[model samples]
Target: MTTPSTLPAAPGPTPAPAPAAVPAPLPRRRRRAPKAPSALLSRAGVTALLALATLYTLLPLTWLLLSSTKSRADLFGTNGFAPGREMHLAENLEQLITADGGVYLRWILNTVAYAGVGALLAAVFGVAAGYAFDKLAFPGKERLFSLVLLGVMVPGTALAIPLFLLAAEAGLVNTFWSVFLPGLVFPFGVYLARVFSASHVPDEVLEAARMDGASEFRAFRTIAFPMLAPGFVTIFLFQFTQIWNSFFLPLVMLSDQDLYPVNLGLYVWYSSALSQGHPEDYLLAVVGSLVAVAPLIAVFLMLQRFWKSGMTAGAVK
Candidate 1:
């Protein structure tokens, strides 16, 4: 039976069922949300803040300026910011110069000596030490640097008594050296010098200088010094300001009035005016303050360019 035409052709081998049709997936097109702009304060708000800060800083100085021009009666009687009936700026200057047999001039000279010479020496010392610290290798270098950093944290007031004691032992108390010598060891200046040296002075330049038959000191003096000039000026200005405004150190060291710096002199005048019931002395004090601030202003103006350069020397790459 199977051989007979394959039994109806074996039902054509039971033809396979047609496969079900499947749809293709659509291409995914993801849509992203737009980002919002960042919020910022208006320009007016920033300008207002800066103007407020400037007013706060300059308000006192403006009051002092106005006060310096007032007469003794007007100084206390009138509003601090108002002009007096009679301008006494000229009279105040005369009195300031002639007081205590011209002792204020002595104070000015003493301040110059202490601040100028001391700052110069301190710059020299600081720059040399910083260069050595940055470039030279020695045992205990890091430890010594750490000590210098520690010194930076110690306030000048804390060191005044010890410095006075040391000066007394060295027979320098009640002398100009007592005040001047202490101004020569500014740890902050050294720290700044080190930072400047590290950032501004390259090792390869120094090495090249050495290869040109320059000794260490010669190399520093010729090559490194030029590179470190901005740093030196920065250190000098810092030390100068510190020495100029120093009061406690001079108070502890100098017993003689002729050796007083401007700050101590002003303090003495202010204290005497308070205790002696002398109202004119109060006007004198105000005038003296104005006079004292003049030099600092002049110095800042004169050295503004150098100061700016020095301050920003190591800031950028």
Candidate 2:
């Protein structure tokens, strides 16, 4: 009987919460400026220096070429770069060959034989010594190599007198053997051989060869010598140049004009020019100088591959 109806409560509007404070976004970072082309300046400077050095070296050569083209009268009168009215190069070359009963040709042949054979022999001996020093273990190896280093330090010029005496004792003075014998024992060649062998011929490879029943000499001849051929060329070329351009030893050893190398022969011409008051010899001297450099150039051009390969092989492990 007590039924009562409950009434719903009336809704009221609520106040909005105060707006939360908004924070400002941080500024975007600016990227750093790229580096300036400072490297280009360094490269430019190096290029300029190299160019200047090249010019310095080539300027004299140019002068020599132009001067060689001139006649005796034009040589003194004409500016160094100016071409002379008379191109006497052909005449000068003819005169060089025919002059002094063609002694210059003899000098040329003598030089070739001495430099070619001596350098070839030196390479063989040097490589053998170097290989032995690098690969073989023996008593006095270090001591012997040290002695070799000492020999390298001794000036070739200083040894000239002693060499002269030795030649006199052997009665080899005024002979090709005097020059050839001394040129065979290049201390630096041995040094380079040791260096190259240490780098190129791995001990492990030699060990493997030995384990495979290869004798030490057999392993060297079959395996190591082939690897060392590039070094051989290097030593050969070096000794060749040394022997070709050698003046002092020849000067001391040979009294015979026919036995002189290009260097000593040119020196003879130079001295005769001064003494005889013949400036024509001056032109011959220049022409001979140019001719002397040709073979070396040819050698480098022909064997450039071996040299470059040897160097690259050396740098690798």
Candidate 3:
């Protein structure tokens, strides 16, 4: 050990006791100033977009409110949103009622009858068809459902000619039945019913009822119907709105103005206003438009509970 030979002299001086490894200056974390658009600006951008949308929707409603106050001359002559000297809404309504043996009221009654009866029948048929498709093991179930889905893609406008022809063959053209019959054949309603039944009516439930010796129809009526109630209301509301706002079908089928729904009736007024030089009918069209929307609003408010409940049920298992 004492005789351990000295190592040959190295070319470079021995490095001083290896300095503790420093972490390569840790890439100087240049304390960057906050990004130009901070979180507050991002939130503000979204709020501004929503505000613009709200203003766009309400702007026309605001104009309608102001327009309702003006007389016929003021409607076209005055600035659109400016209030006029005469508040003629009451006078206009009175005239509207007295016209043609108060045919507008008859139109209103016919609309209610058509929408109510048609929507009820639609709901019933849709529910039955949906229940059968969802619960029953029938031939061509998927194929039939695909057909129904395809029906949704067929524009109602395109079917008007064929429907008119069928109604003509049955001698039902221009009758309330023409409208009612078509409304009852709602493929969309059937689709919705199928979705609701599949989601809400568990097979376990039907099996349990079957085990208890309950008839199939009895099981569905007593057990499945309750769960389907929320879905039914939603379907009813959707169908009702469809029938209520329907213009093209009634326009083609029913020649009688009194049989017209509000939408069709208003359209007639709009057509008349266009041909006739009188602008009074223009005001009527606008006011009638507002009134037509009111029932839909009321229905939505009344049935929003079902809609909300249905959405919740749809999301839950």
What's each prediction's TM-score? 0.86, 0.84, 0.83
Q: lDDT per residue, candidate 2, 1-317, as tens digits?
A: 99788888788788899999999999999999987777547888779888999999988878878877778889888898899998988887888899899988898899989999889988989998999999898999999999999999998999999999999999999887998799888999999999989988889999999999999889988999899988988999898888888889899999989888988888878787889987878778877877787788788788878978898884655
Among all windows of ten consecutive residues in candidate 1, which has the lowest summed lDDT?
A: 3-12
**Pairs that collide, model 1:** none
Pitting candidate 1 against candidate 2, the one with the higher TM-score is 1
Better of 1 and 3 by lDDT: 1
Stretches off by above 4 angstroms in model 1 are 1-42, 312-317
Query: Cα deviation of 283 in candidate 3 (Å)?
Result: 2.5
Instruction: Give Cα distance to truth, residue 120, candidate 2, Å.
Output: 1.1
lDDT of 1 by residue, 1-317 (tens): 36544344334477789999888989889887766543335577677888999999999889989999888889889998788999888988999999989998998999999998999999999999998999889999999999999999999999999998899889999998899888889898888888889988899998898888899999889888898888888888889888999999999999899999989998988988999987777777888889888887887788778878877765784
lDDT of each: 0.88, 0.88, 0.84
**Pairwise TM-score winner, candidates 2 and 3:** 2
Off by over 4 Å in 2: 1-41, 314-317
